[model samples]
Target: MATAFKQIEDEAIEMARSVAYSMPIEDIDMTDSARFVDNTHWAFFERLRKEAPVHYCANGRFGPFWSVTRYKDIMAVDTNHAVFSSEAHLGGITAKDQEDDFILPMFIAMDQPKHDVQRKAVSPIVAPANLAVLEVLIRERAQKIFDNLPINEPFDWVDRVSIELTTQMLATLFDFPWEDRRKLTYWSDVTTIDVSAPDAKMTRDEQRAILIECLTYFTGLWNARVNAAPAGDLISMMAHNPSMRDMQPMEYLGNLLLLIVGGNDTTRNSITGGLLFLNENPGEYQKLRDNPALIESMVPEIVRYQTPLAHMRRTALQDTILGGQHIKKGDRVVMWYVSGNRDETEIENADAFIIDRARPRQHLSFGFGIHRCVGNRLAEMQLKIVWEEILKRWPMIEVIEPPVRVKSAFVKGYERMMVRIPG
Candidate 1:
């Protein structure tokens, strides 16, 4: 089996080289697969995972981007912050929308000291200890959303279940009015979508404007709470915290935006992705039904399989060599976590979905080192709730229609999924 897979991968390598070298450099982004819901993108990632693990793509949709597939290669890039830094000086963590001299210094794009300061401000609230308080609320909301999924009919799971549940959770956490929860998802989607397609509805400038307006309003809410002598909300937590030294208003806003989107979209997609996977692999779904106890172990497998965030880009701080590839100072390195999680070298029986694996949660989806997802526990808790409620309410689900993937590769998520929910 191993030898056969290797032969197949080698053939794919040659195919990729022929395609990459001959293709026009002008169009190299992942947009081509936006509407194609099948696993073509995953197939492309699988090919790279085997051949030229850290290969380069000089021209594509994102344009002249470096590709880092395979588990070890992604781990190498993810762990070495000093060598593969997130500083915008190199190019931020993305290959597109890069302007000449503009900087959007979110904490995710900065190195220590600066990253440390802003990260520290929000650390207390998201820590496992503090976040435990919200599990009840999160679980309750997830259950309500799952139940409303039309147990006997077909519906769009992405909008109704995924987006709706996640937005409500974000609103609850951010202290935003419940009616405005959808706006959080709206902003997150607009902000994360790549500004490349000629028909792209929202431009980066427009997104920035919306982001600024939203943050200004949030800041006002935080201020009102502060002036009222009771900082009860998440914004209030940040604004009134004396420990938040040297944190600028923009930094605060960036962090807020990050939390709103990060907390919402990734988890939402994971939910939809998990359900869609289970629907496609009914045998695996049946296996889970038989071993319902495996849900705990399955959480990690779900994360590994779905890999909510497709890729994260980093810039080289200085001239360095990665897995024999010459990475010069200021060169951007893109790490494809989706490919890494599926790398056969690291995972035995890498292609199959195994929920009962001994160590299933081992993937770079939540990232690594200091920048690892702070809300990982909350995300897990949410998934657990969904699965728990799923088995309790309805034991069988059918994929009436194939899932539709989001347009952007940044977040490889379901834009539409139709399933038959048997009550």
Candidate 2:
């Protein structure tokens, strides 16, 4: 049965590759979420990187946009914040444009002095001293989680491990109510869900309503934090910070959602992806088991291999030449970090899931330049602690079936992955 599944999967990948190569370069729309759901966006990206590194999609789902597929090209766009903007009014960070009524003016979508100041407000949460403290707390939580998993029975790793751990960490960051922690996971999903997809849980209007509920809930927390003395939690930090204290309601909600999704999705998906990658590459799994110390490097490799948050969008502030292609002012540009991370011209054996790459940190998963992910160190610590605890407990956690992937070009992740642990 497993062999049959593997064969079907391989055949599907071949078909995807064939279509990707046969299609007209101008007609190749990488924003099709169906391709992402089946993990076939890889073939599309491969073709783009080789043939048209800075290809334009004239009729994308979210309208016309430019796709930056190569590593160097993506880096150029990411670093040139002056010419390529991330302003919310200009569509924000995702490939899809942010609706005017629901615009979330978070720091990531801002340019220049505003972005720097707002980001600085929450920077202390991942300070070296805070991370050291979090390390201990994370390890304790991981051990408790693993201790409760059922032995010799299949379970959804996405729910049992990935989402649970990351959600718990997010709760800690926000100092949220323990019983309502699962709400964080829900809000994060709503924040990134592609509403146009066939399987969308709700319409864009519905999603906005739910997110407003999230804002209301967080507003209560913000009000509480604002009244109290300053503390280490993210909400309290923002509440006390002079730069962030006077943010508008939508802006406050936007930043809250940013931190939630940032803290939730990237780490959650990477945890699940690490297990799937290990099972696919048994040799690397054994290498990890043989030298548990490799966890240090393995953590970053997992993040790169997963490449969570597949792309970040920017709008051209003015006419610019990227990779010899002319981009006009106000044009939407998307940097495919997922493609860039896998660019063979840049990283040696970019497709392989080797755990011990000499320079494991050389990947675009956390992005580049000033707008990079803020909670990166804390994310690394969480993954490291989870793996360390897993090594000590279970010799192997078998992936019984392929993961059910999320259908979104922007958020590359899994919905569920069934797994079993030998007793």
Best model per lDDT:
2
Q: What shift in Å separates residue 335 of candidate 1 from its native position after superposition?
A: 0.6
Task: Give the worst 10-residue stretch by lDDT in candidate 1.
Answer: 1-10
The residue-by-residue lDDT of candidate 2 on 39-96, one tens digit each, is: 8888899999999999999999999999999999999999999999999998998889
Model 1, stretches more than 4 Å misplaced? Answer: 1-38, 97-102, 228-232, 242-246
Clash pairs of candidate 2? Answer: none
Give all candidates' CA lDDT scores. 0.73, 0.92
TM agreement with the true structure for every prediction: 0.88, 0.98
Write one digit per residue (lDDT tens) for candidate 1, span 1-423.
223433454465555655554544433344344422344565566555655666777666655667788778777888888888887555676656345444556777778877777777667667676667778787788777776677678778788877887888788777887876788987788777666666677786886788788778787777676666644456766766674534677666666777887888899999887876676566778888988888898887888888888788888778988878898887778888877887777888876777888778777898887678878888888888778888887787666665666766677787787767665
Model 2 / residue 360 / CA error / Å: 1.0
